[model samples]
Target: MTINDIKNLLNATVVSGHQLLDTEVHNACGSDMMSDVLAFVKDQSVLLTGLVNSQVVRTAEMMDMVCIIFVRGKEPSEEIINLAADRGIVLMKTSLRMFPACGILYQAGLRG
Candidate 1:
């Protein structure tokens, strides 16, 4: 699904890269641990996390992820948003917790 679709599915607010909302993401990974994400995730385009740090954006960039969804209503600082924006990554915030956010996307046909 597109990042726009995921935003609609999760009722997320776009924090950055709004112009790229139409970007397609076939898989997702939900985690707050950058180490776990770096060690295990593969071929995922979207990251759902509660962590709101620059490191999160770095991890997503390194993993070639196109989007990051901050769960539990966590909002990233301007630094983090700028970093993702610089990397051309979409950033979104949602009130839903990690599990439900992931589930909603998965149920909508996004895998992993």
Candidate 2:
């Protein structure tokens, strides 16, 4: 599904990479642990996380994740947002918590 679809599905706000809302994502992985994310790579994926820090952006970069969804209304700082933006990564904030957000996307056909 497209990043736009994800944003709509979770009623999220685009914090950065607004121009990339149409980017396609095949799967999603929700995690607060960067270690787990490092252990696996999902192609054309989005990282759904509650960790609103620059490390999240760095992990997404290392994993080649196209988008980072900050769960449970967590919003990253300006530095974190700029880092993602500089890397051409899409960033958004969703009110849904990690589990529910991941479930919604999964049920909508985005494999985890």
Candidate 3:
């Protein structure tokens, strides 16, 4: 699925990277622990996370994720947004919880 597909699937709001909303995505992993996301995620283009910190962006960068979704209405700080913007990562927010967000994207045909 594309980033735009995810946004449509979850009714997410773009926090940054408006131009990148059309980027494609293959897989998704949801976690609050940056360490777990870093240690295990592979070939995942989208990260559905509750952690709203710069480390989240950094971890997604390390894992080569194309987008980071803040679930349950979480928001990233300016520092996190800057980090993501610099890394060419798209940032989005959704009111959906992590599991449902992942499910929505998965049901929409995203796979790792």
Ranking by TM-score: 1, 2, 3
Q: Which residue pairs come into collision in candidate 3?
A: none
The runs of at least 3 residues in candidate 2 whose Cα sits more than 4 Å from the true structure, single-residue gaps closed, are: none
Local accuracy by lDDT, each model? 0.95, 0.90, 0.87
| Candidate 3: residue 43 lDDT (0-100) | 88
Q: Tens digit of lDDT per residue, candidate 2, span 1-112?
A: 8999999999999999999998888888998998889986656479998988899999999888989999999979999988999999999998899999989999999997
TM-scores for all candidates: the values are 0.99, 0.96, 0.95
| Superior by TM-score: candidate 1 or candidate 2 | 1
Ranking by lDDT: 1, 2, 3
Clash totals in order: 0, 0, 0
For model 3, how does the per-residue alpha-carbon lDDT over 1-112 read when each residue is reduced to its tens digit?
Answer: 6798888889999999989987877778889998787778788888898889888888888888889999999978889888889999999999999888888777888874
Per-residue CA lDDT of model 1 for 1-112, tens digit only, reads 7999999999999999999999988999999999999999999999999998999999999999999999999979989988899999999999999999999999999999
- lDDT value for candidate 2? 0.90
* Residue pairs of candidate 2 with colliding backbone atoms: none
Q: What is candidate 2's CA lDDT for residue 60?
A: 92
- Number of the candidate with higher TM-score, 2 or 3: 2
Global local distance difference test of model 1: 0.95
